[model samples]
Target chain A: MINDVWILATASLVAISCALVGVFLILRRQALMGDAISHSVLLGIVLAFLISESRSLPVMLAGAVIIGLITAWLSDTLHKVGKLQSDASIGIVFTLFFAIGVILISLYAGQVDLDQECVLYGEIAFVPFDTIIWGSSEQGLDIGPRAFWMISVVFVIVLASILVAFNRLQTVAFHPSLALSLGINVVFWHYFLMTLVSLTTVASFDAVGAILVVALLVIPASSAYLLASTLKNMLWLAVIYAQSAVLIGYALAYALDSAISASIAVTSGVLLGLTILGLQVHKIRLRRQGKATLLEKA
Target chain B: MQEWNLIQQPGTWELLIEFWSFEDMNALWVLMGSILLGMSASVIGGFAFLRKRSLIGDALAHAALPGVMMAFLLFQTRDPLVMFLGALTSSFIGFFLIDWLPKNTKIKPDTALAITLSFFFALGLMLLSHIQGLQVENKSGLDKILFGQAAAMTQQDITLLAYVTVFILVAVTAFFQKFRLIAFSAIYARSLGVPVALYELLLALLIVMSVVVGLQLVGVVLMAAVLLTPIAAARFWSDQLTTILFLSAFFGALSALISTQISYLAPAMPTGPWMVVSLASLFLLSLLFAPSRGLIKRYWQQRQLRQKVSEENVLRTLYKLYERRQFEQNDFNIADIQALRSMPTDMLKDTLKHLCKKQMIRESMRGFCLSKEGLEIATQLTRRHRLWENYLNQYMDLPADQVHSQAERIEHILTQEQEWQLEAELKNRKSDPHGNPIPENTEGMSRDK
Candidate 1:
């Protein structure tokens, strides 16, 4: 039962952190950038292992963030300077990075402990086993799951960054040129948001893996985009949606005896579908009311 | 390090020799499967690349995962046909969702693609995990579909891959022109009485089929590279769709051959990543070194143009200085030329030296003078410039002052035929709008020289 709580807490923290940064991604129309970074960060992890010869968390996070930035910068350069189409540039960059990561893993299969399967779907079920104990082994206090603590730090950081730079991020995301004219560093904010995204992705890697991290980043924010009229509301609503997905998805996974992370992603997708359906129904009802009012006047 | 040591082993040569000689039937089958998969994916992917839907293959591949899992759960078998059909059905549904969401909802196409891709992939993972927990037969290799293990492929898998790939290739060839039309301009194709919607459906089906079959080799994660990079590289080599299609197929086949050979030699190295990495290398090569459109070639061409333009501008500047002297003096130093038109001292010297090397200018103690050939060329340039200025002044209603800068750029590019047309349009005007004598059209004289 305690194991279940840690899983849900870890998943919710990951979802909220991802959705917090993802709202800006949606606002900037760069949701696919989230997808691209998630994939390419695999290369960073592999490279980090190769260089450091250790599986330390800081080294992996640093490597992943740096590669994530490079992925963003390189794709942007390919789009702008190389004159490749945006989607093709993104497709080329991320796939190439992922392929290199896979190759490195295969070539160094003896040294690298990571496997392609764990990198793809992740093993969220094992979260409770990897606990962090404070103090000495004799009387150490068991804090929580290591993943839960890592994600909590990331969540606090993300929440702090958003709070501190809310208007600047909002202006840059909505009107980049106007923000530039107003003396806000658009490029800085762009990378700032990208950094937040990278941090969130790396932190969530333990629970959701790489690809499904994109599901968490894109779906909740996109659903909120459909419903919320303001960025603040969208941010809050996205967090709400992400939390609910964790709760419902955990229950679903428990009932079906399936993977929790995948179930969470599925739940988020279902929630987005329901949001779309609800909006459509609301529109039809509103149109019917308009027709009724016109007919009564006639 | 181990990989390098293995490469140095004497046994590695025998493995390479065995791979090429087809001694190992498994290697042969995997090689054939990858080659066919590469060719067909690249050929069909060209249209998607051209249509700018390069990432749709990725979405469809992810969307196929659940279908594969569902097929396994339903049939309790791993029949290639059942898996293929399951993947195709789900991929088609994904295609429809990607097509529908952007049109009907406020979600942009990229977001729609992300949503469909991740949602389906997550759902598929869910189903796959559930299958993994169940005590089912042949569920062991089901996870291989995620990253694909070519060595695990059986002969039946190869046969199924062959049929699907060949069918895709034939369909693409049979409907080449129609596909080309729709890819380039669907609205134009529709106006010409083509049933664009039906053809689009056909194209989407072909894409999904190739993507489905390719899942067992290239896998889902990097399949988009196989579909996009070859065509992107091929684009640098050619402009026409036919040439691009052939070149992309060739690249695809070549990458497949190389990757399959490497995987057969190293066994631990997967075929899919090697294939994609080799393809990306090809893309890098084409991006840098392809003849006309490649970056290096374009940079070289631009440098040459800059040299030629600067050289001509110096010649024209020297001619203008000579004109300031009422055509008596044919020579002037760098200072005199700079007085008329400013240029860097070193650049002016370089331009003058190149002109001298071309025998268009003579270097003496006084400065530089136009040779007979150079004078004739200068006369022609001046005539074209002044004639353009006159034409612009008369037809475009520009003031005399504004025409010089406009003519300055047009003079170098104005062809002889254009000069004659401009002169005729200006009605044989002798003086420019600036009241300077338009140098006589020395075309016949320059040819004589």
Candidate 2:
């Protein structure tokens, strides 16, 4: 029972990292980029595992980041030169690359430690077994699974990096021309942010499957976008929504004895649904108040 | 060693012949079905595109996921009929939410689409995992539907598609006038006693139907392409109602066949991407060589216009030289006019012929001179130039000489109302500071030029 808390904490931490990075992705309107990157990362993860003969964290991260860069670069190039629309270019790149990844997986994945089932569904249950300890000079506290450590370190880096660059990032997301005119190094920063989003996503892949990984990256931030007026407020709301969703969803899954991550995803969805419904109710109340003023004037 | 290899290897040429025959048959079926899907989607997408609701298809495709899972949960099977019905239900509700949310709430459509897309896809994932845990018999069918497996399509798919195709054809034809009028001019359509709301609802329903039918072949991600590609490809061909409809059908038919053939050839590839490739190729071809709108044709037409503009500039320069006493003789030949402008000999001769046809300039043995009509036109043009310069200098606060360069582009597009406003603003200046006379306004000057 006590160990269950650790798992929950770990899962929530993973969710938080996705939500944190998602804030900017949603603001920049790169929501579907998450979906494209998720599918394309399969090629990277497979190549990394093949070369390393194991799931080396740094190697896998590097591979996934490379795939992310490829997806972004391919989409941008097609849009610029081929004169295709942004969404169409994104669709073309992901479908073709993902098909190649599918073929590769079908041919070579048969003999490896990986399988299509792991690729699509993911396996968070087995994460606790893959572990490492660090800085345990004292007899009591030690580190846990390498994924836990990876996500923890990543969370700190993402939070600190975003905190420092918040002003510039917000400016670029809203007023790209203004940011460029003011010497924001807009091109480098865009790629830098894409890299961070890719790293955070690959880090969360072990806990959540690819599709739900996409769900986390877009939903909470979009929900916050609806509920807030300013970028600062939106980011704060997004963090709250991401964590609260994890907690509520974990409890519901525990009660129902269902999968933890899947339930949390549905809970995030339900939260957005309820927010929409609440907004409807508020509109009706406001309309009623307006009608009352008209009646008084009459 | 070569002889031994030949003996060991079976001839793939004979095998290839057999494969090609089988592929031809399969490609025909795929093409027929793609035609059905493409035509219906375009007809439906036409309304959506006209209404600027193209992204609605995208939103609804994502919205259908959870509904599909819920249908599976209820039916306990991956039956196409049940799943599609369920998907349609949730997708409609998703649109209802998206539509209702903005009117009643603070959330915009972008956020609405983003949330619904993520939420429904997430819920579907949860339901998918649940279905897996229960060890459902047709679990693999779920995976096939997600990414699309066009090869596994059997006789049943063809039959269902044929039925839907007929329904869409009859329905669109029956409502053609109403749909067209509604698409072209909504207010006019309403005034004609058309059921505007019902027409819109039916349009949305058809779009959802097209999506559900194509989901088995294109999946959630690229179904919008199936809806968009044929129309986009056909847009290059013609704008006439009949031509657009027929050409879009043809394009859809062709794209589907190519995709289906590719899927058959490469068993590993999905039908959705093959379909996209064919659609993209059609659009690329259209961009290069479509009759009216192709890049090549536009470029050629622009070259003709530039030739005319350059000729006019030279003739105007010659006219200026005559005004400055360079060509003191009242009549001069084309060769003398060409020398004054320093233009190429043959090109100037060709342009001079075109000008003589327009009656703007005429040729004598001595040189070229402006016609009486040409003088009035040139004087009007010159007056506009000086007047605009004055207007810009006074209103825009630019230097008097600096305003001349800016008016070069503005003189071409300035409307009469705008010119009048400019004249009023400049207080009807009779002469430019350059000492050029602002020609007097004359009757029929406005109509002639």
Candidate 3:
């Protein structure tokens, strides 16, 4: 029971952090940029491991953040300077970086502890095994799973950043030129959000892997975007949706004995589908009410 | 050190030789299969790229995963055909979801693509992990479809790959014109009474087939690269659709050859990444070095245009100075030239030197003077500038102040025929909107007197 709580906490932290940053990405039409950064961060992790000669968490995080920034910068450059289509540039940059990451892992398979499978779909099931012990030796306390701790810190950082810079991020996301006109630094906000995405991605890597991080980032925020009219409501709704997905997905994964992260992603998609259907039904009912009111007046 | 040992192995040379010699039947099959896959994927990917749906291929490839898992669970077999059908059905469903979500919901297309891709991939992962826990035979190689193990491809895999790729190629060839029509402009094709929806379905089916067959070689993660990079690279080399298609196929085949050779030589290296890395390299090369549209070529063209514009500006400035002096003196010093127009000293010197080298200007004790050829050219430029100014001020109803900058850019590119037409249209105007006298076209006339 405690293990399941830890797993749920870890998954919820991941979903919350990703969904918070993902709201800005979807608003800016940069959802795929989130996707690109997640894939390419694998190369950063591997390179950091190779360079630092250790799998220390900070070094890997630093490596992933740097590569994530570069992935964002390079794809933007390719679209602007190289004159490639934005989608094609995004595709090329991430795939090349990912290919390099895969090749390096295979080349130094013995030296590096990471593998392609682990990077693709992380072993979230093993999160409970890697615990962080806190306090003194005799009465040492288990501080839940290491992934939970990492993601908790990330979730706090992401939430605080969003709260602190809510208006700036909103203006930059919705109307960049207007933000610029109002003396806001659009580029600074862009990289600020990208850094948060990178940090969230690297932290969440243990729970959800790289590619599915995109699922967590995009799905809940998009669902919130459909229902919420304001940025604040969207943020709140997305977190709520993400938490619901975690709970339901955990139950589903437990019953099916399947991967928890994938189940969460699938659950979020189902929620979005349901949101779309409900909205459609609501629209139809309103139209019917309008017709009945006209007939009564006549 | 491990890499060094792999390279230094004595058998490496023989393996390369054997690979090229086709002595190993497995090597031959892998090579043939990759070549066909490369060609066919690039050809179909060209259409997707043209339609601005490059990443949809990525989504569909990921969407194929669950279908493959479902097929395995039901049939309890690893037959390529069953897996292909399962993947095909699921990918088509994914294709429709991607198409349907944006139209039916408030979700933008990019978000829709992201949702469909990741959701389906996650569901597939769930099924795959479930399958892994089962005690089934032939389940060991099931995970290979994620990253693709080219070396483990059996003859049956090769045959399936060959058949699917060939069918895709032939179908694409048979419907080339129709496909091209829809890809370029679907609304126009619809207006022409073309069944655009049917053709779009056909294209989607072809794309799904190529993507499914390629799962064993390029895998789901990087399959989109095989479908996109070659066509992107080929686009830099040509503008014609047929030429682009041919070039993209050629590039695809070439990358496949290079990657397959490397994979065969180094057993640990996977074919998919090598193939994608090589294709990316080719794309970078084409982006940098292809003629006309390549970055280097475009940069050079811009540089040349800058030089020409600056050079012409200097000549025109000198002519203006000469005209201001009532044609009394052709010789004007650098200081006199600078008084009329602002040019940096170094660039002015270089422009003067270039003009001298072209024999358009002559240096004397006073400073510089236009040679006969230079005077004629300057006269023609001045004439074109003034004529454009007059035309814009008259026909465009500009207030004369806005005409100079517009005339400045147009003077550089206005052809001789355009000059004649402008002169005729303006009825041989002698002065511009600014009341500056327009010089007559002095071609074939002696001005030395």
Candidate 4:
């Protein structure tokens, strides 16, 4: 029970971070990059582990950041120089980097147990053992694992970044050219946003891997976006959705005795589908009511 | 050791020689198929770019992943034929989901795509893992799809690629005019009795073709990149239909060649990455070097135009002041001319000298005045400005104050015929709404000029 609570807490923290970063990415139509970040994080972790010969958090995150940069750099190059559509550039760059990571894993199969399945669908069963300790065990209530600490810290970081940059971010999200005309560095803000997304993604990859990372990032944010107009409301709704998904998904997986990551992914996807349906019904009902009132006035 | 080094040690030419010696058939086949695939994808991508449906490729590519994986597990094989059919069916399904979600539900394409892509790919991942647990790994070829392993090109793949290309080409050519009309204006096309549904379906098929053809080269994840990048690169080259088609093909072929070369140089280098890099490099070059749209060309054009505008502004300002009885005598003083505007004395002197060389202005004792021809030109311009102001106020229902700015923009743009039509429409008003005299008609302002 304690172990389950610890894992549930870790999932919630990571989910919040992903949901937070996703709010703007979806608004800017850059949500797909979140999934790409998850896949490419494997490359970062592998390269970092190879260099440090240890699976430490710093080394792993350093690797993830570098891979994220490479992914972002390639996408930028494709967009600016290649003149490819932004989405196309993202699609091309991340998949290629992800493939490179796959080949690297295959080449160094002996040193690493990472496979394509693990890369695409991360295993949450092993997350509990990867604990973190700043000092003595005598200290009260250790923050569980390094992954938990990483995500909790990442959640706070993402939350702070979004809060600080929210206004400029909203302007860019709504109309990047308009933002540029206002002398705002649209590109600078965009890269900063991407950096935050990559960091949050890396923080989550240990628990959910690439595909689920997108499920966590995109679906809740999308549902929230569909239901709200204001960015502030959307962000809060997405956070709420993410936490709910984590809690519900953890409990459901516990009941089914299935792989937690995939169960969470499917549950969130279904929830998104349901939310979309629910919103539409609500809208139609409101429209009918509006018509009824108008008819009464007439 | 020489054989082991695929790129630096043994060049493509050498590889060709060795292949010919060994009678390697599969390599030749993959190369041929990739060329056909490359060409068709670019052609379709060009149209997609024009329509701004580039992201649809991103959506469809990811949507097809689960289908490919599910087919692999169910069929228990790595045959190109079955996997492609699986991909096509699934891509359509993805397309259906995108269209359906919006109409049946309120899901936007972006949100629907994101949802579908992740869900489908995750499902595929699960199926793939289950299959991976079995011995022989019947679909090991499936893993190569993520980034694409184009170098492992086989004869069978080439044949399939050729057939698909041919199939797409026939469909596109058969409805070329309809496609263009629909692409340019759907409402007009629909009103003109064109079957909007058929054309739209063709477009969806073309998008599916773009995705399915490159499954072996770029895979589901990056297929959209190949489908969009080439067209994007080509857009900078020409707006003409024929030229755009050729350039898109050129970019596509270049990407294929570069990706193939990369795969050759680095053994086990996946086809998708190589293709992406190749396409990216080609796109970059086009963006920098393409005529008219390139940064260097635009910058130079703007610089030259600025000089012309500054000169034109100085000449026009001087002539207008002379028309108001400010500087009519010979040997005009430059200081008085500078005082009329906020421009410096030296700048005003330079403008006076430039106008003198052009015989349009003469420096008088007081300041600057228009020469005979310059006076007529200035009168004509001022007359057109007020005429437009009068016309807008009387005919277009503009307020008196609003007509000045509206007429200002129109004066610089109206053609000779348009100006004459406006003159005729007002039936020769003696004075403008502002009570200024309208300029007399001149043979010089005839349609020929």
Clash number for each model: 0, 4, 0, 17
Ranking, lDDT, top scorer first: 3, 1, 4, 2
| lDDT value, residue B41 of candidate 1 | 97
Every candidate's lDDT: 0.89, 0.71, 0.90, 0.72
Which candidate, 1 or 2, has the higher TM-score? 1
Model 4: residue A77 alpha-carbon error in angstroms: 14
TM-score order of candidates, top first: 3, 1, 4, 2
Interface DockQ per candidate:
0.64, 0.22, 0.65, 0.30
How would you encode candidate 4's per-residue C-alpha lDDT over A1-298 as one tens digit per residue? 7777778888888888888788888888776677667667777877887778887777777778778877877777767755556766676566556656765665566676566556666766777887876578777555577778788777787888777877899999989999999999987887787778778888888788865788788888887887787989998998888888887777766665555776676677778878877877988999999999999999
What residue runs in model 3 are displaced by over 4 Å at the alpha carbon? A1-5, A128-146, A284-298, B1-5, B444-449
Cα-based RMSD of candidate 3: 2.9
lDDT of 1 at A16: 96
Q: How far is each candidate from the true structure, as Cα RMSD in Å? A: 2.9, 8.0, 2.9, 6.8
Q: Model 1: per-residue lDDT, tens digit, A1-298?
A: 9988888889999999998898999888888888999999889989999999976678878998899999999999888856789989999999999999988877777788777777877778898998888999889999988888888888998999999988898899889999999999888888888888888898888898989999999999999999889999999999999999999999999899998999999999999999999989999999999999999999
State how far residue A56 of model 4 sits from its true place (Å). Answer: 10
Tens-digit lDDT track of model 1 for B167-211: 999999999999999998999999999999999999999999999
TM-score of 1: 0.93
Model 2 per-residue lDDT tens digits across residues B182-204: 88898999998988989988877
Candidate 4 chain A lowest-lDDT run of ten: A112-121
Candidate by candidate, in order, the iRMS in Å equals 2.2, 6.0, 2.0, 4.2
Candidate 2, which CAPRI tier?
A: incorrect
